[model samples]
Target chain A: MIVADKKPIEEIIESVKEFKKILILGCNECVTVCEAGGKKEVGILASALRMFFLNQGKDVKIDEQTLERQCDHEYLEEIRDVVDQYEAILSLACGVGVQFTAEKYHSTPILPGVNTCFLGATEQRGLWTERCQACGSCILAFTGGICPVSRCAKRLLNGPCGGSSKGKCEISKDVDCAWQLIIDRLKALGKLDEYEKVQPIKNWSTDRAGGPRRVVREDVAL
Target chain B: MLAEMEPPKGVDISVMMENASRVKGEIDAFVVPEMSNAVMRMSALGGALLLQKNGMDTVMQVCCRDRNRLALQADLLAAGASGVKHIMVVTGEDPGFGDHHQAKAVYDLTLLELLDAIEKMENGHDMSGIDLCGSPQFLVGSTVNAGLSAQALESELSEMNQKIKSGVDFFITPPLFDIASIKPFLSCVDLSKTPIIPTVLLLKSLGMARYMARNVKHVHIPDELVRRIQNAPDKARECVNIAAETVHAIKEHGFSGVCISTIGWEDKVPDILKNIS
Candidate 1:
């Protein structure tokens, strides 16, 4: 899932300081699962903002609403009737959702409430680690199910670069050696022979290095 | 003849070679290590140029972790033009391993990809099919792990064979505490003509030895050696003696010359060389 972290209250206050009336919009999808910009978080942020304004002797009107999914147009239409009532919206969604909401709303200032992190999986409730870079070209099949581009510090297609000590990356003890894991997994699977096959230089056009990507299928397209 | 050494502080060659002169005749070429911990110093190629200016042959170590193919190829051609004859290609340590934790690593090309590009350049063309006015020449080398688990040896060798097939002129192994530790790796790979230079690191203290054994990947320090260093009366002297002894053992095993990673203990290299010779 696309992970995001809640913005600090101080930063959020600074962003909306100029506006007295604002809508705190939340997403029920990735931000919800990550607990950043979901319904519960939106409620907490609204209360916090209200308390801040009350303490400052300022009256700020804040409205809270959580969309099923901020990225889709269907869920976004529900906010059109009320969006004009507020000066701005503090979106508690990933970057994609914020942009989508802004595109549809057109004039309302769409403010981000959370920092979008990466495409990752939750190791536990509080801990999330990156798993994929969405590099477009996936080589997990050759790497024993591990993603080198996301996991390897150098993103080396052929590596365990000389700095790996034990099974850890040279950058830190906390990071695992992606190549080491690949070799170990291949060894366990009795496919160690595959480890030596050097992959060609990557054509990064399929990755973010190329540009914003788009996928179109004629069969599904009208 | 390549003496594996760090770049001098501020890249002051005079101060750097002051200690290097102690082993003048012993080392014909010097190999400079790339920056560790993201702490800036003289670049590997820059250090090699300094050494070459001093009348010593040098091998500039290049890593794929930081530079893209364009930068790498540019550096290689620059080194060749400067008369540097050898290159040691390495997949550099992750930047997180260094002090600069936030630096983004640009592993644009893998070790194989870099090596392949070097081979292509040697054959008179750039990676993008741009023909060079003059093809640069280099004796390309790479590093390998000496200590591998029995189960992982085949996989490691496959990587080694790939390096060999990519036109690596020689393979330099990580530091070896015991010759026996590398025998399993050696027996599996055919190194009939290729020279396998075993690295010998000077273990300064029990802590250093233990840290390497427990933390460094693919490096195995024997328990006996660790105990010996732990119990030694004078660790400094014992470390030198052990290094000299290992160099002798490596030579006796019919391996190519030793690459001693002195790690600031270069002052004692002459003694180690004298003792071994």
Candidate 2:
């Protein structure tokens, strides 16, 4: 999921101090699961900001709307009719949602209420740790479902470099070595030998290096 | 600069330390706990937790809708052990308003009954009437929201006063978005001895203010601050700075202290606290 943290309220207040008619766009994807940007989050933020604005003696108008998925164009197109009417948009989505809102609403300014962190899954309440780099590929199969791209400081395909010791990353002792995780997983799957078998370097062209990527499945084509 | 924040100047520190030194003096912040966790979501829970963890000396909020009396009692015990210091009682919002639409709700105890039970527990009896090996000493608090309906508000306050008589140490309020929101209710404050900590909702975004204006019944968002948020170059930060500024205003208005309630935008609380101190 697209992990994010709500932009500090003070920072959010600073971003939209100029606009009266505002729309806070919430996303239902990663931000929602991570408890950063969601329908409820948008509602709460709207209420709190309204109270703050009222206290400051400023007249503020806010419209709260949550999208099924802000990163998708179809979800963003839903608010097309009214997007022009608002002075600005407060996107409670990740960076992708903010950009999507910005792209869709060229005439209106779209602001971010959340700081887009990397892709992650929720470990539990109030804890979200990064998991994938989304480098336009999935190498989880070879690494036992753990993405070395995000977990390892160096995205080594077959790792446990000399720097990794005692299953701890050399950089931060507090963090477990991603390579060690890979080894544990591979061991569990009886593929510990696979790590020893060095794989060839990946093709950078298929990743973000080549620019925007699109998926077209002929079976599902429009 | 990682924001060099020391305990303000000597005079300020002295006054602040003096205030801090009164920890045992029986004064409580009495901020409203978000009773409707599933209805309001964990952001509300997260917000309250952050405040208590960050040193607001906050109260733990527990409502009856999400859990049965067992869950409520367990969480109550958890909050007590977590150093939350206080607990607020509420018969939470209905589950129909929540995402778990089809989920069943268990309301084993009403707000007043919950208070009585807590009081009994505080006096060292378990809710089951059995002697517990250990029990926590908690300052039990309750909420006081001026209902959108006038008569309901009056009856609620009277009922709340009754709760206070049954060992509610203090009372916290629903968001006081505007002065008018609190004024009419303050004129009717019937409780004596127990301090009332009026809550000020910190609106951190212009869009948020307008959302409350339309959706939240009883809460009114003023036009002026919205206009300022509309005019500021950075609206989100402006929304929050204005909120921090509001905390100052609320403190200045002679309320006990501001109950920092912005959950999603809690980073602003430190800023608000910085300015308030």
All models, RMSD in angstroms? 23.9, 21.0
Over B1-277, each residue of candidate 2 has an lDDT whose tens digit, in order, gives 0010112212233433333333313224424345344443332234445445546555556676667677766666666676767666777765556544444456678877777777777777777898755676787767777534577777877787798788887666666656555666767764345566656566767788888888887776778877888899988767667766766666666665545566434344455555543
Measured with C-alpha atoms, the lDDT of residue B174 in candidate 1 is: 83
Per-candidate TM-scores read 0.57, 0.45
Candidate 1 lDDT over A1-222, as tens digits, reads 999999999999999998989999999999999999999999999999999999999989999999999999899999989999999999999999999999999899999999999999989999999999998889999999999999999899986788999899999999999999999999999998888899978766577644467888999987
Q: How would the docking of model 2 be graded?
A: incorrect
What candidate 1 gets wrong by more than 4 Å, as runs, is A1-222
Residue B17 Cα positional deviation in candidate 1, in Å, after optimal superposition: 1.6
The per-residue C-alpha lDDT of model 1 at residue B227 equals 84
- Model 2 lDDT, full chain set: 0.70
Segments of candidate 2 deviating more than 4 angstroms: A1-222, B1-58, B147-149, B190-192
CA lDDT, every model vs. true structure: 0.86, 0.70
